[model samples]
Target: MKIPHKAHVALVDGERFLFLRNDGQIFDPKLSKVEEPDLEATNFSAGVKHQDQGGQISGSTDLNELAHAAAAAEWLNAKALANAFDELVVVADPKTLGEMRRHYHKELEKRLVGEVDKALTHEPLEKIGEVLANA
Candidate 1:
């Protein structure tokens, strides 16, 4: 998973998210933190259907966390609609990734370069770069 130069990288989880940019070359990425857009949790009631997946969303044990993940996906969708970045990579926990997948806008899908289903939100920037370089 070589991160293209200046590519936007989002490391997200249910509770935390880090926005970064790769300033170096594809194989040797220098990740620099970037300010994230103001994000608000989406309020979803229990049993709401997922239109794209054609599945009922049963209540999660951690409803708040699920809402937060939905919020992250919404933010990403908004960014995609705005053409905020040309290339995007997502590194998120499995649950968050799945939630995001259900809500991804077509534009976001086009710009997405890679996704890693792991919880990397808390990892240091250097560690994240290393992992991505080897991915």
Candidate 2:
């Protein structure tokens, strides 16, 4: 995950998000913090319950968290449609990544540089850069 210079990096989870830009070189990347987007909750999965992979009943998932992830995905979709960023790298928890992937626009898919399936939303900028550098 050597992020290209100027690539937009989106670190997101159900409850939080941190946007960043790679201001340094590809190998020695410097992730500069970017402002949070003006996003509105889509609430698409507000009350949804996920079935277990085994098709068996399990404890219910957090409805609010699901909705939040959906909202983040919605925002990304809008940005993609508007061609907001030329290169995009998504770093999210596995569940959140799945939600975002479900809503990816074709244009966004084209711009996507990479995806890291881990929750880095609250990680420090240096840690994030290190993880991406080693990924």
Candidate 3:
């Protein structure tokens, strides 16, 4: 399917996110940054211990907490886009993508135009469009 012109694109991972707006150009579509949150500073550790069925003990990292934080960020981004854009594309790692799906608001879900289950947070800005196009 063709990506909508001037749609908002969100690149997200477990610990970082980038918001870009498509400029509606041809192969030379311009993407401008709208926001990048400091996800590294947001701790997802539970700092607690748990016992397994085998009586084994482990210091469990709170994956749920991480997912919640990531979902919240996505929600905020979606809310911001709701007013300015009619479509949104999300490119997220598999784990974060699941979290986003679980927490997406009805309004955001309605505006979703596309989704890519790949981690592109570390890719260069110039390559994002190419990646999305290929996906």
How high a TM-score does candidate 1 get? 0.85
Candidate 1 backbone collisions, by pair: none
lDDT pick, better of 1 and 3: 1
Candidate 3 collision pairs: none
- Using alpha carbons, what is the TM-score of model 2? 0.86
Candidate lDDT values, in order:
0.80, 0.80, 0.66
Give candidate 3's error at residue 91 in angstroms. 0.5
Tens digits of per-residue lDDT, candidate 3, 30-76, equal 67788775543232332112224333334233454455445555555
Per-residue C-alpha lDDT of model 1 across residues 1-135, encoded as one tens digit per residue: 879999999888878877889998999989999966556776554114433343325434455566777777778888779988899999998877887787788998999999989898888899999999998
lDDT of 1 at 2: 79
Candidate order by lDDT, highest to lowest? Answer: 1, 2, 3
Order by TM-score, highest first:
2, 1, 3
RMSD of each: 4.3, 2.8, 4.9
| TM-score on alpha carbons, each prediction | 0.85, 0.86, 0.71
What lDDT, from 0 to 1, does candidate 1 have? 0.80
The model with the greater TM-score, 2 or 3, is 2
| Model 2: CA > 4 A from native | 46-60
